[model samples]
Target: MGRGRQKAKHTKIARELKYDTYNVNYSALEKELGHPGDDQYVDKWADQYADDDEELETA
Candidate 1:
């Protein structure tokens, strides 16, 4: 969302999971989730996944 929030962390995770690259191409992860844009969208999707994961774990 805003700056100075460790945004690259999500991108790294996504890359490890084969979601996207530095150039931000929509990998299978983005396609499945219908994510648009480049790195920005990847970051947003990653955050969403993290939030969802937390919710699931808590549930």
Candidate 2:
């Protein structure tokens, strides 16, 4: 497609998105926001490469 046509199509989509509103699920949002006792993340690769990381830091 021509550049002008592509630009006009983008402008139309942008205008529609700017004015449109949709329903929000507040309960899901709250759940995703945070929860206590949810800090169980573990990076096994970082742990495995601990010696290499220390060598880089010292250099």
Task: Please write out the lDDT profile of model 1 over residues 8-57, one tens digit for every residue.
Answer: 87777767879644565668667877745554534535644557677899
Residue 5, model 2: lDDT of 96
lDDT of 2 at 37: 65
Model 1 residue runs over 4 Å out of place are 19-59
Weakest lDDT window of 10 consecutive positions for candidate 2: 34-43
lDDT, candidate 2, equals 0.83
- 10 residues in a row with least lDDT, candidate 1: 39-48
- Record all residue pairs in model 2 with backbone atoms less than 3 Å apart, i.e. clashing: none
lDDT of 2 by residue, 1-59 (tens): 59999999999999999998978999999888765466876566875665876799999
Residue 36, candidate 1: Cα error in Å is 44
